[model samples]
Target: DAGVTQSPTHLIKTRGQQVTLRCSPKSGHDTVSWYQQALGQGPQFIFQYYEEEERQRGNFPDRFSGHQFPNYSSELNVNALLLGDSALYLCASSLGLAGDSYNEQFFGPGTRLTVL
Candidate 1:
């Protein structure tokens, strides 16, 4: 089975522009988490979704939002983009809730977003 996949491997946007990145989870996975990775920095958690609801969120501002569908696909939407928003946006899929220690997350190749 295919692992997690993200659309538009790369994206370019200007400040104040909006972008939406898509992700399809691995087979049988039900939860999806989004992260942002800056140059030379580890991925920073953005938010997590399970059962079609956002279960947790990191330090990102309100400009970042997301949604999970019944089929386990997800979309990360960023509004009023800024230069600081330029980063590799990652999508990870797991089998259970965020608190489940036994659940391992499989990450996608990531969508690289560049803000000018």
Candidate 2:
């Protein structure tokens, strides 16, 4: 089965410019979660999508949003991005949401976004 995959492995954007990154979940997975990993820090959950609807979210502001397609692929959209948004954006997939034993997530290499 194909594993999770992310596009643009790397990106560069200026402060205040919006960016959209894509993700394709692993085969047979239905849940997709977006995470932001700043240098030296652990991945922080941005939000999660299941069955094409956002099932759970984190402490992120309105500037951060996402969408999951019927195919189980997803996209992370950041609006009015800031310098702080520059980080490695990771996409993870699981059979279900957190707390479920079946939810052991698989992560992609991530898109390294650089905000200038």
User: Which number leads on TM-score?
Assistant: 1
- lDDT by residue (6-82, candidate 2, tens digit) is 99799999988999999999998999999999999999999999999998899999999999999999999999989
Q: Kindly provide the TM-score of model 1 when superposed on the true structure, using C-alpha atoms.
A: 0.96
Candidate 2 versus the native: TM-score?
Answer: 0.94
Candidate 1 lDDT tens digits, 24-77? 999999999999999999999999999999999999999999999999899999
Compared with the true structure, the alpha-carbon lDDT of candidate 1 equals 0.96
Worst 10 residues of 1 by lDDT: 96-105
